[model samples]
Target: MVFMGIDIGSTTSKGVLMNEEQAILAQHLVHAGIGTSGPAAVKKELLAAAGLQDEDIDYTVVTGYGRRTYAEADSQVSELSCHAKGSAFLFPDVRMVIDIGGQDAKVIRLDSHGRMTDFVMNDKCAAGTGRFLEVMAGILQMDVSELEQEAAKATQTLRISSTCTVFAESEVISQLAAGAEIPALVKGICGSVASRTAGLVRRMGVEEKVCMSGGVANNGAVRRAMEEELGTEILYSPLAQFAGALGAALYAMEKAGKEKEHE
Candidate 1:
């Protein structure tokens, strides 16, 4: 049977297709997310990639911030649950997960059986999120993707005192005007985000074999800074951004199997 999962996040949408054996058939990511064309775009591209149509999918599950509004899903799941499942699937020994998305950051702890034990989220502010980095990169007149390369060249790390996005932006500007090196400032920006996220991780209690999910996990500079702040290696996959979608697809597969058994 064919199963599908879609994660409609704040700034991106991800989709995954799988078969009865749980083998991934296709995966797609769209830059636009909920309330935009992201969800529809992911569905179309994912189906086309797998050489299948919507009706061919035996089950469809949705997760993420926009899951409730997505009418095409057969069911909806919470991002927290989905992330836990996805991270465990990717790293079977993972005991902790840190997901930094566009607008928020979350730290989740899992039991030995891969069940979620505790989680802490920073949904109230934009600091320490992908949006925060994007804003900082913009002020530096550079693309967000260049942050890692720039940060790598830093000779020293400047400390950004403000944890608020607006205030941090002002701090960056002030430092730039004062002849601060851009690379050092970039490293500092990443360090600031790491420090804030580390606080959340500490609140939930750090565990070994920590894995990182979400778009920010793709940022090498931020990941390095996070590893240093937490004093542990953060494991991540190239498919990190799709973890939520993959987890939802796994749920779809399970649901499909159960329905067939009942029939």
Candidate 2:
């Protein structure tokens, strides 16, 4: 049977389809574009991925910042739960999950079975989120994908004084003029974000076997920075961007199977 999961975030939407055995049949990521268009667009892409329409889906679940947008979902779950579920699948022993999205970041502590125990989230600021990195990359006349690599090469410690993206860019410029190496400046930015996220994770008493998910998780700099701050290697989900969707889909499968068994 075809089970689907959809994660509609501020900047992107991801969808995934899995079979009864939990094999991923297809996955797709699309820009959110405008308003609820992200989920709507993801729905279209999901249909295209499976070569079938919405009705063909045996079950559908939605999660993410815009989870509420998919009112027709079989269920709408918190991103923390979805992240934990997804992380556990990727790293069966993961007890900590850090997910950095465009507008928000989350640190979820999970039990041995991957169920969430507690979590903290940062949604009020862009300091350490994907949006901050993207905005800073733009100001530096560079691509967001290239930002992490540059940040990873710092030879000296560069301090980023501003938590705000706008102010950070101005600080970066000032540092650049002061003979701060490009790598140092880049590292500073990554370090700033890593520090912010690490603070929250530390407060929760994070454990090893950590897994990170989200589009930001794709950034090598960000991952390394997080690792340095945590002093451990973080596990990666093959489908980082689609973790929320994959979790939702997996949950949908369980729900569907339970319903079938009862009938």
Candidate 3:
């Protein structure tokens, strides 16, 4: 049977199609433009990529910043729950999930059975999130993907004192004027973001076999910062960015099976 999942984040929207085994069949990622047309536009693009019309889906699960944005979905779910479900589906041993989205960051705790026990998030701040890194990237004239590799080449530690994006930008300018090494400054900025992320994860309580999800999970600098602060290893998924969508798909599949069983 086929299942579909849609994640409507602030910066990006992702849609996925999968089978009962959770094997991904097709997926699409698109920039989420400003306005009220979040899920509708994203779903249309995803449906096109999957080579199936929207009605062909067995069930559809929606999640992320715009969970309610997908009014046509069979069900709307939270990003935290979706990440837990999706990560566990891929890695059954996962006891923790760290997800960094465009505007928020979350760390979810799960039981041995993969049920969510508790979670913590920083939805109000950009300090520990992808947005923080994006601003830093702009200041450093570098991309997040390259930040970690550069950080690894740093010869000294550079300090950044501001947590606010605006203040941080000012501090970066001062650092540049002081002739701070570009690599060192970039490393410090990433370190600050990771430190904030570690703080959120601490609220959820650290556990083994942690899985990292969301688009920012693709960043090595963020991963290194998180691991350093948390003092634990992180497992990365190639499909990290689609965790919410994958979770939705899996949930839709299960719900469909139960419906059929009753019939």
Candidate 4:
């Protein structure tokens, strides 16, 4: 049977299709998220890619910021638990997970069994999130995707001491006006995000074999900075952004199997 999982995040929607064997069949990501057309688009694309229709899916699970709003899901799970499960699936030895999404950041500590032991989250502000990077990218007149390349050219790292998004914006602008190199400024912006996120990680205590998930994990500069700040190598997968969705799908598979057993 096919099981599906969808993650409706603040800035993106991701879906995964899997079977009883736990092999992924297809994965899709939409740039638009909840309150937009992202949910429908991701589901439609995922089904098409897997050569299946919605009715073929035995069970559906949802997670992320907009999970509760998605009516098609058979069940819903918290993103924190989902992240831990997915990260463990990707890196069986992973003991920690750092997920930086559009508007929030999370640090989850997992035991050897892949169960979540503790987690710290920052949902109160946009200081260490993908949204913050988007704003910084806008102010720098470059796309978010360009940040890594630009940051790599930096001769030195500049300091952005503010943890408030507004203050950081003002500081970046001020530095630009003061003739600070854009690359250096970009590196500083990434560093600021890393530093802030690192604080969250420290709250639960650092552990070995850390994996990063979510859209921001795609940012190499941020990952490098995170590694530096935490003093450990960070692991990530091309499927990093789909970690939550994949975890949800795994849950769906398990639930579906239980139903079959009961039948």
Steric overlap count per candidate: 0, 0, 0, 0
Kindly provide the TM-score of model 3 when superposed on the true structure, using C-alpha atoms: 0.91
True-vs-predicted CA distance for residue 27, candidate 3, Å = 2.0
How well does candidate 3 score on lDDT at residue 86? 92
Model 3 regions lying over 4 Å from their true place: 33-45
Better of 1 and 3 by TM-score: 1
Provide the lDDT at 183 for model 1.
Answer: 94
Pairs of residues at least 3 apart in sequence or in different chains that clash in candidate 3: none
Report lDDT (CA) for all predictions: 0.92, 0.83, 0.82, 0.93
239: Cα error in model 1, Å: 0.7
Cα lDDT of model 2 by residue, 1-263, tens digit: 89988888888988888889999888888876226566777778767877887788898888888887678788777777887897788788888999999888999988877888899998598888988888777767888788777876677868785367778878988887787788787777877788888888898887988888999888877788789999999887668878888898988898899889999
**lDDT measured at residue 160 in model 4 versus the true structure, 0 to 100:** 90
Give lDDT tens digits, candidate 1, residues 24-119.
999999999889989999999999999998899999999999998899888999999999998998999999999999889999999999999999
TM-score computed on alpha carbons, candidate 4: 0.98
State the lDDT of candidate 3 residue by residue for 124-236, as single tens digits.
87777888878888877886678778888888767665367778888989999988998899878877877878878887678998889998888777788778889999999
Q: Model 2, residue 126: displacement in angstroms?
A: 1.3
Candidate 2: deviation at residue 252, Å? 1.1
